[model samples]
Target: MEFDYTMTTIKPFDVAVLAVEEEIVKAGMRVLYVHDVQKSLVEKGFQRDQFKIVEFCNAKYANEFLNADIKIGLCMPCKINVYVKDGEAFISGMRPIVLSQFFPHADLGEMPKEIDQIIRNIIDNAK
Candidate 1:
């Protein structure tokens, strides 16, 4: 699951985020919450309409991962964000596997690969 698509010019960040969402949905997971960052920011006095954070979780994945290591919970219930900048829509998110790099003892080597694939697929399908 290298998630390296050389044929397309889509930003890896956006693709990865969208891929995760699509994969989770295809896996029969439910969206627990969608925080509209643009609206929230506006309400908070930020003048912008190009930010959003999508929170999703698969119960089975979460449970299994948590049982494997509780510390991983800090990055659980993954989030993907959609935002606009310089006339382009950009997607951003935190890759759990990348985060795992900070903690070598955490066994997320296998899980991050799966997650990366999901994210790639999402980006591939984005219009």
Candidate 2:
């Protein structure tokens, strides 16, 4: 099964980052964190392309999945990444449905499919 959802954007890296955060909120998910991977690396005396990791979650959905199988906590708080590579900007995330394959014993019901669509929508709109 496809495990990732990715989209290339013509928007600048900074613009794509804001668009992603805005889309996440518009989709009714709360942004938990934004990790500036490149900044972190640069601060440590390294240089790399721009990259940001945005983490978000819908409380109700998270509760539902966790209740279904506590082990699902390992995947809690979904993430979408914004990055510049080879002069191109990209917005991407792991497909939520992939969790089903990772935890076959858990009954995810319709949550993964639902989340997968929301994430894909976010990436498309952000781009």
Candidate 3:
């Protein structure tokens, strides 16, 4: 089966970012940070396209996992990358639920699926 990590939108990056931010909070999660990855790359003197990364987490779910296995901290603060190239915009991020398969304790729990649906909605509804 093919796993999805990235998505495209007809809207420009600015509008898409707004939709993504609104969708995340509407899902009852708070955004942690919005990283300017393209700027970071530009500062390093490498020519690159524009890219923004939005990170977010829900405290309740986060705590549930931490209470299960501390190692899962490695994937905390799940994020989405918003970028524009050739006049097209896109949002990209790892499927935590899919990757959670490696951590049976976390996968078996309902939290991953709960969060996955929210993330999926954010991606699916963003314009």
Which candidate number has the best lDDT?
2
Cα misplacement distance, residue 18 of candidate 2 (Å)? 0.4
Provide the overall lDDT of each model, using Cα atoms, as 2-decimal numbers: 0.62, 0.94, 0.81
Tens-digit lDDT string for candidate 2 (31-82): 9999999999999999999999999999999999998899889887899999
- Candidate 2 lDDT score at position 103: 87
Worst 10 residues of 3 by lDDT: 99-108
Prediction 3 global C-alpha lDDT: 0.81
Best by TM-score: 2
Q: Residue by residue across 1-127, what tens digits does model 3's lDDT show?
A: 2255678898877788888899989988899999888889999998777889999989988888777788788888889889988867888777767646667755447776677777888899885
Compare candidates 2 and 3 on lDDT and give the better one: 2
Sorted on lDDT, best first, the list reads 2, 3, 1
Query: What is the C-alpha lDDT profile of model 1 across 11-126, one tens digit per residue?
Result: 45345445546655875666677677777878888898466577877787788778777887887687666666665666655655574565577666577767755655554454
Model 3 regions lying over 4 Å from their true place? 1-3, 85-87, 105-108
- Model 2 has an lDDT value of 0.94
Provide TM-scores for the models: 0.73, 0.97, 0.88
Off by over 4 Å in 1: 1-24
